[model samples]
Target: MPVHRPGTARREHHAAGVLLAVLSALALLLTLPGAAQSADGENVPPRGSARMGQGVLEHDGQGGEPRGGDAVQTEGVDVSSHQGNVNWSALWSSGVRWAYVKATEATSYRNPYFAQQYNGSYNIGMIRGTYHFATPDTSSGAAQANYFVDNGGAWSRDGKTLPGALDIEWNPYGAACFGKSPSAMVSWIRDFLTTYKARTGRDAVIYTATSWWKQCTGNYSGFGSTNPLWIARYDVSPGELPAGWGFHTMWQYTSSGPIVGDHNKFNGAYDRIQALANG
Candidate 1:
């Protein structure tokens, strides 16, 4: 017969209670907002230097030919503070025509190299525009839009200044969809678009990946008629677009182009790019 000691039982119960308490605390921590766990189960904070296409490059692999099967397309590139002091002359010499510079993010971050990248592209005769990295989890879309406009996302009829683009993709910091449900995400986007148009009188361009769009926004299509879509897909072709968009206005074909930043394609010829800027 096995003899059960009273003290042993009491000690075992106390140890089990401690273990359970620890586990419960861990579970609660994981449920907290901005709590992110890596694949190896390590907690990781959000990256502060999130740039244009950072999520796309992280989720989607690089390398691909431009889609549209040999159709006429104007080349472009998108840059952030990562590509400090871009060599605009070299990109211009490489047949690049249009550029998008990272402007503001979540109303908190403004690209330090915005002036150089934005003006250098324009000075090099490239139709250049700005983009705002959306962080719907941090602030209201309208507030972020106002912040973007005040910083560098304003539009002009200079015939070389393209309307700003809203770069909404996977959250590099925490939850992929910023912890919002599909409908809530859609509403946030609508608010941003509405406010952007009100501030600039131009429908802002939307830069997104189809997979992220479908997963986050439930494949919302309401913006297709107004916002120009800048689709990011690094493959032999732009696989499939999100709902409502009949065609992509811009396609980011490759992240590892022979240039400084991610290379993209304006869906039409150089004249179309100029037309978009002129608008």
Candidate 2:
């Protein structure tokens, strides 16, 4: 065997050590879950930053104030069984003009309070709509969308009924992206929107955080101008929207508001909002 110099062996060993370190770091980054990697790797701000009982603010960069500067906007609330026995009349009297009720979740779970919240808000002279909480891991989007419409997503020519909304946010059960690839999530959303529109004759609104949308759906913007965007961010200006949307349709600014659940701001005036409800 050829004899090697001691200094050369030391240099080689050092190089190998550096290489192993680099590989380990790369592996760790690859294994880390795709969280909010928006601009500054900070989007999807914390929930209920400006609330009474909500916890410490997350301060993610994804959320912000409503758009449409100088234009008068409408305030609304979104609720489900989480907020038990809502007082819709009091909310209306408090200047809340609209509501989005959680109607269904995944494929099997339906909100028991959907009828009461939906009809209650409408009866109190508030524009009301139903939203489906997407559980992509549990079932296909089309199936979930059908279940939503069958339960409470169907809208009528009644001027106060807004189109159904697709609530695609964090994965409550499993992986953050529901263990699906970005392309898979985009496909699921398309399936849900396609089926929803076909059944209801109206486009479904999409509610998501900026970073969550980017991470989960690869920032999919295929819905174009049809599906309205409802961006969820607490205590910050929605710095950037997802692809294909310059402004948001509604902004869910907080979770614990005057009436509980989520507090929302429609981007346009009451007339424009009425126009949206009509469709």
Candidate 3:
């Protein structure tokens, strides 16, 4: 028979209690919304939740741009899962004529709120489309594009669904350019654009910032001629466009809007938005 030491059982009980408390706390964190558990049991930011212009506002400070002035532009907003069940009717009543909802990120995740946001906007009579956040480091662009289309980035000729957009901006996770060289970045973009076009039969809009375009793609001019540009600049006049694009099709002028965080302006009038949708 072994003799028990004084206070040994009490110390063991105290240690067990501390361990249980720590585990319970971890479990609570994992169950919290927007926190996802990876295969390795690590808590990570929810996949497919990266929003359009997420890094723009952080990288480039907002600039002054008069809203609804003499400029004949259409008001629009872009949203992701972060916006969760947006109030489309309020936006429509506020003169927002178009919207873009995020569909996927890389090839791993899809927006869980895609249906509510995508269909709700259309039902409210707003010309709407979906966008995919590019994570060039995770997978090939073609694979991400296919995942986007398979998820919710598909297009239709209903005159209400605009073609999907590829959001190739600053990488929010790790490297600014996802650790790819300029030429490699350009090739990745080309792969994504080509795949998206092949899958949907429409030229996908390229959403990026001038600085990012110049830095990551070495200011590649080839995409300008084919892909419609959705320039992200909070400046007064969209600052400067990327190489080869004479004009921007859409300009995200502000990340702080009346109702939504990301607001944009279609370069032309409402009819242009319709025309873009028609295509």
* TM-score per model over all chains: 0.84, 0.76, 0.84
CA shift at 136, candidate 1, in angstroms?
A: 0.7
Ten contiguous residues minimizing lDDT sum, candidate 3: 38-47
Number of colliding residue pairs in each model: 0, 8, 0
Model 3: residue 224 alpha-carbon error in angstroms: 0.9
Residue lDDT tens for model 1, 39-155: 767666544477777878678776556546668888899999889999999999999999999998997788989899998998989989999999999999999999999999999
Estimate every model's Cα lDDT from 0 to 1.
Answer: 0.90, 0.78, 0.89
For 97-132, candidate 3 gives per-residue lDDT tens digits of 999999999988888888999999999999999999
Point to the candidate with the largest TM-score: 3
TM-score of 1: 0.84
Sort the predicted structures by lDDT, highest score first.
1, 3, 2
The local lDDT score (0 to 100) that residue 227 gets in candidate 2 is: 91
Candidate 1: lDDT of 50? 75
Model 3's number of clashes is 0
Report the lDDT tens digits of candidate 2 across residue range 157-262. Answer: 8899999999887753345687889999999999999999999999999988777888887888777578999877775555588997988898887776776777
Candidate 1, clashing residue pairs?
none
